[model samples]
Target: VAQHRANVRLWWTRSSLKEHTAGLSNANIPLFFPKLECIDNANQSHLHRLEAVVAAKCVRPGASLRSIGAADVRGLCGGWLYFRQRGGSPAGATFCKEGTCRMGCTSSAEERAALARSKQIEKNLKEDGIQAAKDIKLLLLGAGESGKSTIVKQMKIIHESGFTPEDHKQYRPVVYSNTIQSLVAILRSMPNLGISYGNNEREIDGKMVFDVIQRMEDTEPFSEELLAAMKRLWTDSGVQECFGRSNEYQLNDSAKYFLDDLDRLGAKDYQPTEQDILRTRVKTTGIVEVHFSFKNLNFKLFDVGGQRSERKKWIHCFEDVTAIIFCVAMSEYDQVLHEDETTNRMQESLKLFDSICNNKWFTDTSIILFLNKKDLFEDKIRKSPLTICFPEYAGAQEYGEAAAYIQAQFEAKNKSTTKEIYCHMTCATDTHNIQFVFDAVTDVIIANNLRNCGLY
Candidate 1:
């Protein structure tokens, strides 16, 4: 325990948290979390191809220890260390972090990355000195019920450095069902809740809006099928249905013009053509806002939908992603393998993986893969076999066996696959060993920086 405390302390010092947060002012958008999703049955991709694909999208311009938040901590051990992804997207190669930032990390590769990052930081800061900073926007994307909210919460509590327990609770802001259909249903059914031109902000107008919000208060589980149902009513010939065939009481020139583009707003998949990724499966970029900190530097994440259609729209926000977190939902395996459901989450996930490996969008990107929702198997339903072989998991090898078995299904396409891909059976519950996730995340980011600086 003393060693652990000592370790955390060392990391904190290295992060050198801002005596006063530099970028954010009191007036800026005071920590806004996107709307909570309420997915009754979110698509779960059993194959981890999404993991490899997503990691291949990270862009890290600064190659310095001071740039990465990994070098400050101590006593690193266990969990994912670093990831080595290939071919897909624009940006730097190798999304890795290390040093004190790889806190409590026991992985050898991660440790090496940390050391390299530290050396690089020392060199860069000494020669060029610090410069102006900017805020990084990260899109947190995942299917409903995949624990995007929980991961956001854990990130706030552990990775942000100075956030109080109270602040952590407010990270996701509230715990609610995060489903795509439900939110669209609310807005589509209640047109009054529309937003201005190009922002996530929403506005509620007219009487029908109140009634609709009240109805949404029921808090029932909403599914993609439901969203599809609503889409039928809202769209006719690729046009908005809110004005009811344009028979509304009145419409300004701007309102009329707005209607033309409104239907396509935030809807990545307005049309479905062959080779259209998301439309072939899940048809939207289901991303919400995510805010966290490392070394006092804020990382606002926006994880877009893993489906094909959504991938097209990610470019809008991919201008400068410091790190990318690609997640593979464990339930996707069950949904596809069991044959009980028509839409196989595993198949959809695999298709997305194929696109990532083959897509030009990820040609230069680097990122990390997350085998999320390990806690789902904690119950007897998904327990491991009695005999398994894996040293890291040791006693849990029986359980770990399932991970290896599943991993085979979604391996990356790169032959070298040189970018290390570390797999962890994560719960996404954000419980014990949760910080390890952030540690791993930061470690990868740092490693990438060091490599860029030519330190490692």
Candidate 2:
């Protein structure tokens, strides 16, 4: 029983408690703990209460041992140590005088350390509140499919350390829908390509597979039979030939990748991998704000729909934005918009960019023009002539030539002469590329902020 008292004494001593325990002994346990079962129960109860009090007062407040006062520590562990007032003597003295003891405790070195640590914690919290108030708001302004959302996703991947398992799982339905939409597009364009099941006498097997693709579209349950049909259509040399001519039809960049993995993706229990989720195409309808901290700078990135109808909402979110990341789909030079088939997508994006640049609300906002989808742009430039969209682009039919012409056009049209338009060629789906570009963008934003503050 004395050993138990010794352990309790050790605990309290390490806890920075400097109180005297003169009348406190194992034999006198019944005097203080009438309800406890035994000495063990009383000791356990005393230890638990001491721990809780210490945590609430000192430990949980980020206190160091040296910063916590001895009196406070003694109060936390005082249950095990009894104190009585002594006649005309020090309150915390160990020995008694005239059957009277008084409670008094001196501050220890550990208690002083606790006080220091508590002060440090308060200082850190204050700094954090200041940093929170100094948050930077970045707005992503682009036409639909201009890689705005992709860049936002990249920010999450880089800053938040990628999506959770649940986030990856949620993309399953989106991947499936993208696959269906791509196949439907190819099927719809088959007739225009002068190749259908009713015609195309030069390729009998192509006609059969073409008919299978149409039939699989209506099949329910997406059963193994449908999977086999799609696989047959996908693997057919003639169909493969048609897909290779991607510019002839309106197909997503993810079409070939998704088609190549029909068996796995078509599985009932299929879970989307990170790459699949990254490549999956889900059109942005409204604004999505994502907050993340990168390189000690807090960023709130806003992504809004690029269609004309959705442009009205963009004006509401433009207030106090630190910078504008204007995304231009470099690959859409020849393609028309889904919202307005009569207007070319690239032309519409250019007009929208002009409006955003000239707006008085964003006169001071730094513009970052991202010529996104470089991979698709390269392929599209090779297949489709640049002259089809902009006849005055007198550059050679080359990637660099076309890209430079487009960049020059945008730079020439930008109305914000106060801020230099920062432009970069980017593929947003590429994480490594985004990380590099984002690091550069961060430096630019920080420098710009410092320059603005200097002027103020």
Candidate 3:
């Protein structure tokens, strides 16, 4: 007979099925009982006795679990069974409960043994997933028009298609992202995080660990919104934040976009709109390959262009790179210098170099001065002499003449420099030449090992 009562108050007195069940086989009647952690066919003393057990969790219909029968169910049965948070809010949690069940069961009060097999299987899967990551050191740097995306594509396709010599289409990849989310995510993960307290805004210690989250449950009561936000921050890597800005950071993407770009433009003349953001296409893409092996180390980097107003942003990237790559765009002085606008751009790059060389990140960083678009220049003008048109030298003014002119400009400002900067030319399309830049970076890394050199 089936008994149903909300106030029945079924308290499971532990019993063994073999001893209590007698000849009561499940064939006569399949009894539905309250949450049961363990079942024994040995006794049938008390009908539906509960020592401890997890609740019956619903599996997706036609899922792999359907193939699991009574044996698998018994094998998996445990007082600490768990559910996955693939989606939705598991409002609270529970560990043990006093509930009722039907049919023959054992009695007495003894803490049940936990399931070891299933737990071990889950542990193994996690370890394997972490080990699968490719542990390669990389330096990603490029401008929007530069063939950086192409290079990344070539590397990926070559590994996939096994290096085809007959025909190779130039590769291209489009990358873009927002900022605020990236900052909050990394910051939230830190221990002993500082939080504003009350109206006084006194800083307070407020830090939570992930393990505490994994141990939470639905019935126990917890903040669904907080949990969801935490999970989302860990899952996504497109959000960005600028460290170059003041202590406060923007959380909105559009707001951040306008601020960062506006700050870069230094435009006091006119205000920008959402339409500006919609039409915003990066004039240049900056890629810096930063590799790490700290569990989940997904990076969301921001492109800080070498434009004069934007030069300062590069300082932010310094504290976050495996290696720093300096892009020197190749353009004929007479051609690219056609307008005053372009002259300012060239000047901006020079100023940036000066800033970078003196920054603290400079001494420890592996540097590569990538003079891209070398194909446009005469192949014979491999090494820049003291004289030559800035980027062109076919009947172009000598490097020294241009250098002297540049030097004279500095002298006029009472800031003449003596040391010459070594600049390497590279046609971004040429992999062999690019590899040299890569090796140069490696050599520097060996000279100064900085794998765990975190923020100051």
Candidate 4:
């Protein structure tokens, strides 16, 4: 009976040992169960229990053998068994392996150090998450020629290092193109307007201007013959009349500005001025991202094409945006869309704004309305009637009432009572105006974001 009892005890010890070491591979035995000359047969049960605790603490789910370190084993084994024997929790307890049972061992320093490191790693992760949440993402959206791209340029000038020499050089061709294209558009519109050229002799000059438009490469500079023709045609009372009635047709806002300065534009060595860069028009085709730091806050402004065909790409940029800057050409109230002359431009802007302001993707996003091109709008309001776009208007044809009515038109598009549209009257070509408006905009953005975070 004594022999059988001894045999049962030995079998029980072997079973516990196998169960504890089951997770350790043959190659990792030395790594975790290093040779402990201090351990003896008397403490073999304690060793098995310590091994179980070490396996439980150090063998993480996805941890490989190489990631398991000796310090980790030491950290786990330091005081685990002493606490287990006393029916106490092993947490923050130290074990002594000096051939006797001792609690609160000195080797627990490693465990405390590992705990400190874990806390620091957790702290760093939290800080990174906070920073990511604070980043401001702005989406620029509106109808084409609404001055969205010009706002992007203003940001570059204000925040980034102003344009380089290469930038001036690049815009030189664009300025020339604007100058030539504006003249050709005027000449083409004359026939439709039933207006004759001021000079019957200058009809040949108009033909020369048309030829330049057909064959001129983007990089090609204006020839003296073409310059002379544009000057003569621009001076023609007939062309001037057509230009005054430009709202009836599609002409760039910069056409009059560039045509008036043909001499400087056609000079032998001309570099684009800051104002020239501001006025130059280039259609935004795809997504454009501009980053800047303002008021200690990082900003990422995204400019997407506002045309119907280009708007399909706007969805890809909808994710993670902080706000939307919806630009509307205030002057376009009297004009028609380039795509469809039958469709009024201001009405198109309203429809587009209504679609996005209440979109599912931007239900919580802030909307900023930019009533842009105030300079043109003010000038045109004095001459062209606002009744062309808003025939229901009975107010005086002055700037204040006209401007307020335009702002209200856009504001009425927001169907969400919970969402407020922050509106600004902006002249995109005026740096001071844009700078002042953006400062106010930054304040609103920061305040809204803080309120959303429950920090207000």
Candidate 5:
């Protein structure tokens, strides 16, 4: 009976030790000392023998079995657990006497220290998430080839580290392709416009230009022969006259610039300049993001393709936008849509702006109107009439008066009374103009975000 009673006491003691130690092990703290193997080896068939073994192996010397508590056993085994929790290894743990055992007891200090570090990391992550949420997200939306991509390039030149030599090299082919394509477009449109080459002798030169455009791949550099032929055709007065009526046909805005600079551009070791890169026309197909920091605030600018086919992909980027920069090629007032020639380009832009400015997705979003291509607009207004786009326009064809009338036409598209349209005249190709305009636009974005946050 006494042996049975002792067995009961031993079992109870082992149970107590397991209950206390389970928590420490579950916490991943390594229990390295006072090995539990001693208990595992105890002879279970004889209750008295098991009790004797536990008392001799687990308890401190001269300590009675009844007097030793679970805590004492834990103190001997959990010292390493405490050490590890404090970022110390068992090999590095200093053995110290505690109350009744040579092994150390768990200290609340280590757990508190670990917990504090974890909390600090979590706090930092939360702060970063909040700051990211606070970043100004500007969505660039406009008609196709309205220089939305040019504005993005200007941002790179001004805010971020400007393009590298490798970047200039990469754009070389694009510049060359643009130059070739522009001339080809002009040559193709000449017959439709009933305009012949100024030099009848150079008609073969025009044919050579066409044949090269058809056979030559985009990656191929322009051969000297083809470059010579293009130069001859570009210099023809009749071809120049056809180019003057470029608005009647779908011509790239940079065609004239590149065609005039064929000599330097066609050189063997030619590298594209900053101006060349800005003027290069590569259609934006999907959403492209440009990240930069300005005035201690982070910005995420999104440039989505503006073509009718590419507009469907834009909804994926509509969420969480801070502002919308709706661009319009004011110079395209006399032009028609490349997609649908019957529809006027400026009219298409206005229709697009009206939809975006009043869309349910952007109801609360700030809308900033960019009257882009001011330089081109000023030049075109001298020859073409604003009445091409807006039939009601009775104003003079001067830059200032004509630009205001165009701006009013866009401003009239806003149906919302609460939402205000902030408009600016921008020349996307000019870095100085874009830099100045973006600075002001940044201020407006910051103010709008602040107001949205109820900071004002």
Candidate 6:
């Protein structure tokens, strides 16, 4: 008898839900809508009406609750429970009596949690912005094309999230310009070097090639035909003779790689890869600041042009500088300055280093020397002896020995008793090499800062 009573009660509840949902055919009706009317039944008491409403919420097959979402179910149960606790209605009417159910419906907890997290993130970002404004400053000083800009770029790659595809696209034209400039420089300098093709009859061809290159401007975009002409000229005997004596001219380090890929670079839709961007040379005339954070410390790196003409601007940027990274092109020993062909490039770097080291203003500053372009130096040392440039000293043909000898030459210039020069061999184009050097540099700067503060 008890089981039969329970079955009958459940049937009545499901039947009521079906009728409320318009016979279950209108199941798409929003769950919050007033599906249950509170018109007093002729034979049912207030308690029975409330009980039927509660029983309708049960998860039975015929119950319309199956069509509603879980959130709506929660709202329904919460609203019914709240209504029941308030003693329901006196006219045998309960929840949703005259209007839509509004109780138990509130903002989602997930949304509220997300809002809180957003606020905290905003606060942290504000704090970080303030910190970045007052970051430690470091200046990169080196002669033109000595890889100072490359080191700055490597810093961005290591700590500033690296180059994107967009950066690659932007650098395509710059790489092409670098390639053209190098070929032009080689062509222009061939006559001065007393190099030529085998016979006197072909001298007119060399003159034509030189005039074509001289007329072409680095600022202008290269035409495909011009690119093909350059490729053809690159293989010509006269151009080959100039290339063989490349160390005599101020050619870019990237000239060889780009010259070899003239066909690809000449393509209308050429895109520069990351390595090409790294090797691409664009002389920095003004100070370019790159900001990045590492080890909870913010850093502002300044890359300025290394030419003698740009050195006057260096004095203005010395304020609050944490450290100085002086880059020396190790392979430049055999080359001369682009500005004055009479001055040896390595000698220029040494003289500049001497002046900077002796400057009383930088006496307290930590000096880190980057003997840059190790790859080119290694290759150059094997082909041409280092003794040719520094005839006073005798050294082995080995790369390490030559690099070490050159490193010592720069270190010997430090006049400050307090400032010990730290040195590292670097190939700025290589990210892994730069990362390792920068990691050590960070430690060196931090330790020096602590020592100055008497906190070490």
Tens digits of per-residue lDDT for model 3, 1-456: 122222112322333322223343323112322323222333222112211111111211221212222322233322322212224222332333432121221212321211233344334433432332222234444333334433443343322342333222111010012222333433453322343222221111112323333454311222444334433433332222222221132122223343344233232332223233222223443433322222233322233432434645655545535444555444332222213423433354455555664456444444445555555334223333323333342334444344344434322322324322334556555556655654454444433332322101
Q: Which is the winner by TM-score between candidate 1 and candidate 6?
A: 6
TM-scores of all candidate predictions against the true structure: 0.41, 0.65, 0.31, 0.73, 0.71, 0.66
For 238-268, candidate 2 gives per-residue lDDT tens digits of 5666676666556888898888999888888
Q: Point out the worst 10-residue segment of candidate 4 by lDDT.
A: 8-17
Off by over 4 Å in 6: 1-134, 198-224, 306-317
Candidate 1 C-alpha lDDT tens digits along 179-239: 2223333344334434221222223222232343467631232234433443343343222
1-456 in candidate 6: lDDT tens per residue? 122224323311222222343333324333323333323344244324233333333312243232333333333332332221133332433345422223332435533443344334334434443443345789888777789988888888889878998998888768867887787788778789987654554555445545545675553556765665676777778788898789888788899899998888877777887788899987777678899988778788988764457565556558458788999999888988777988888998899999887776687888899999999899889888887667876878989889989988898898777779999999999999999999988988877765543235
- Residue pair clashes in candidate 5: none
**CA lDDT of 178 in candidate 2?**
76
- The 10-residue segment of model 3 with minimum total lDDT is 168-177
Error of 4 at 392 (Å): 1.5
Q: lDDT: which candidate is best?
A: 4
Better structure of 1 and 2 per lDDT? 2
lDDT of 1: 0.38
Worst 10 residues of 2 by lDDT: 30-39
Each model's lDDT: 0.38, 0.66, 0.34, 0.74, 0.72, 0.67
- Superposed Cα deviation of residue 303, candidate 2 (Å): 0.7
**Strongest candidate by TM-score:** 4
Candidate 5 has its poorest 10 consecutive residues by lDDT at 26-35
